[model samples]
Each structure stands twice: as structure tokens, then as C-alpha cells.
Target: MFNLENLFGKSTRGRRLKSADRVSGALPFITAGETDQGISAFIGNDVKVFSANTTTIDMFGSAKYRNFKYGGDDHIAVVHTNKLPKYASVFVTSAIHKSSYNGQFNYGRNFYAKDADALDISLPVKDGKPDYEIMETIISAIHKLVIKDVVLYVEKKKKELNKLTENANAVKC
Candidate 1:
């Protein structure tokens, strides 16, 4: 584990999206939450270059990997991991989640730019640098496990539903 500042540069300098400025168009409006998907609404006109693939972390320590150029509220802090290669930020995203400071952000504690910078996070390391390849492999494996669990849950529900339907039909016959 090491200080997050060692791995990343300063937070992305950007303005917070105002509710009053919202209009129907393109671009995403991000807000604070565990996983709002960095999308609150779609608007245009106030177009700015926040860029896609940026990572947003909320006060609650929940991190989201935004896949589009998005604007966000004041409560959210954007981490500039652009120096890293494409999808490399995914590992950083996971690291952000593993940070101890994550759960500390809440009603009493607000996670701001400075807080995010100072937080301690653990990363898959090699000869001192982040192990991107291992991170991708671990993330992929966890993804498959989640998918498998979901499939099993759906299958169980279908069986239960079918049994209920069968019993109802027998009574009606």
C-alpha cells in the first residue's frame, strides 16, 4: 500500500454541473453516488472537453469508470489517469475502491480533491510500478464469477416460477 498521489497526478480541473444549466441534448451530467454511472442526464450547448474514460469518485468512496465525456456536480472529484494507456485506468479504478479512505466519505466526511489525493491505496505491483496485466486478469476473473452467479440466480428463479405455475394449472384443471 502506498499514497495514491504516487501513482496519479492531480485531479482533473473542471467546473461542477449546475441543475439550472441542464438542457436536452448530448453529453452526460454526473452526480455523487456509489454508482450513478456518471450519468444523471444528457444535455448539450455547455459542451466542454472533460473527455471519456475518466474516473469519478464520490464522497462515499464509490468509484465509477465513465465511458464518455461527462460533466459532474461539485461533490464528485475526477481523477486524471490519462497518462496511463487505454483501459489501464480500470486498474486504478479498482485501486480507488480498495483505498481505506473510501468508506470514510459520508454525511460527516466529504471526500474532495485533496482527500482523494491523500488517500492510501493498494495496487498490484511489479518492480515498484502498478502491475496492469495482473490487474486486468484479476478483474476479468471476478467479472466472470459475477456473471456466473447471476445466471445461477436467474435459473433458480425460473425453476421456482415454473413450479408455481404448474401448481396453479393443476388446481384449475
Candidate 2:
């Protein structure tokens, strides 16, 4: 297990923006929520984190995987290191979920930077160290499975639609 401080460069709070300021703006102004992307609104470009592979853990224990360049209110934001792979970035978010202090955040306690820095995250061990390659492979496998299922479901729905159209044509004849 490694402390978050080593993995992430430093913790920084996101720019505070109220709901009124969340008009049709440019940047993705994110706040704490259940969403994976954590894009609550699109506001100004004041102090943004353009890094794609970053993780933003909210006060409510919601950890979002930032696949795109965005800005957010930092409850406990962590920028990915140069050595950290994209899949490992995802793994970090998942590991953040399994934190022992996560339960406390449920009762209105925020996941602040100080506590997050101390919290240890379990990793796939190889040679008694974090194995990033294993995490990537597992994610890749799951991605393939999910894509396959989605394709099959779409094909089935298309076939059903085609059958309905054929039935309608026959009725009109």
C-alpha cells in the first residue's frame, strides 16, 4: 500500500463557483456528485486542471475519473504521476472507494486533503510492489466484455425493430 501523496503531485482545492455562475460557459466546472465524469457545469477557465488522467475525490466520497481535461471543486483532487498509466489511474479511483474512512464521509464529513494524503491504497502486488500492468490488463479485458455485450444487445434490438416494420408492411398490403 502506498500513500496518496507520493502518487499525486499535490492536493489543491477547486475554484468555488455558485450555481448562478454555471451558465453556458467554456470550462467543465465540476462539483461533488454520483457522475463518473463529475461535470456539474461549464463555467470560466479560472485555475483549471487540463490534465486528462486525473482523479477527483469529492467530499461525499464520490471519486470521479477525469478522462478529459476539466476543472472542478477539489475536495481531494489528485493529479496522475508521469509513471502512472491510464488504467492505473482508474484503479486508483476504485481503490479510493475501498478506503476505511469512506464510511465517515457518508455522514456529512468531507474527504479532505490531509486525510486523503494519509490514506493508503491497496494495489495489485508484484515483487511486493504495485503492479500497474496487471491493473491495465484487467481493465482492458472488462472493456472488451462490455463492448461485446453492448453490440449484441444493439443487434438484437435492431432485429426486433426490423421484424416490427415487416409486420406493419404486411398489414398494409
Candidate 3:
């Protein structure tokens, strides 16, 4: 069975679809759509520049929905390994906004890609090669553990809150 998550790494998974190609050195040009017909026209014209418009490179089940937004446009593109060449790297654009301090943006990780640009995360690398299978297993295990812990903690907190509410009501009476 094909694992969709495995195909798109967490770093490269959620990225906005822009009409820019690193090879061609082109940037995605944003245009306003007046109506549904105009939107269709934009897509039809962009299909040649972006493979997502015409070719279904990574049009796998559920993968189509697992993409990030580029700018304000909702046009999502499914990232696929096949479309990228051996030298290209996946670019992750993270916009972090916090109200505690002045609103500032920070990219947690800088442009992590698979090729030379790939970040040196604590992923299993044997003989200087990424052991993807081991990394995937580890990630999956940690994810499950975190979910279980969160659920248990929430349930415990709920019971405690209910007891406190009952005590407050009794005191008021």
C-alpha cells in the first residue's frame, strides 16, 4: 500500500502553490478574478506554467487536499517527488504571528528540502543517507503518544473542573 504521508515530508508537505519555477526563475503572478468565468480563465492559462493545472503528478487520494496556500489565492498544488529534479529542493514558508509581543514573523526552519538544501534535522541518517523508513516509524510513534497523552490529560482536567463547579454551587447554596 502507498503511504501518502510518507510521500510528502512534513517540511515539504504544506506549501502554497505559486506559479514560480526555480529552474525557469519565474514567480507566480497574482491576478484578481471578477467572476467564475475569469477564475476558470486564470486556471486554464496557468495550467501550462504549473503542472497542477494540466498534469496530475501527485493527484493521489487525499494528497490533493494536503497543501498550503500561496498568498490569498486558494489554488492548491499537490507537491510530488516525480515532478522535482534531483537537484531541486522543497521550500517551506512558515509565517508565525504572536500577539504577546509585537506581531513578528519567523520561519522556524529555513527552506528545508531533500537535496543539498535539506535541513540536518535529527532524522535517522545511515552512512550520510536519510533512513526514511526509520524516521517515518519514529514520527508516527511520537504522534500517537502525544495524542494519547493529550486525550488523557483533557479527561482528567474535565473531571477536576466538574468537581470544582459542584463545590462552588454548594457554597453558594
Model 1 lDDT tens row, 55-168: 778767677776667777777778876666545677777778777343667878877778778877777789988787787777777778999999999999999999999999
What are the per-residue Cα lDDT tens digits for candidate 3 across 40-127?
2222222233223111111111111112212213322223433322211111110000111121212332211222122222333567
lDDT of 2 by residue, 37-92 (tens): 56777766466665777777777666666777777765545545435788877877
lDDT of 1 at 141: 77
Give the TM-scores of the predictions, in the order they appear: 0.78, 0.85, 0.35
Candidate 3: lDDT over CA atoms? 0.31
Error (Å) of candidate 3 at residue 98 is: 21
Poorly placed runs, candidate 2 (over 4 Å): 21-24, 35-37, 74-76, 79-83
Regions of model 3 farther than 4 Å from truth: 1-123, 126-129
Model 3 steric clash pairs: none
lDDT of 3 at 16: 37
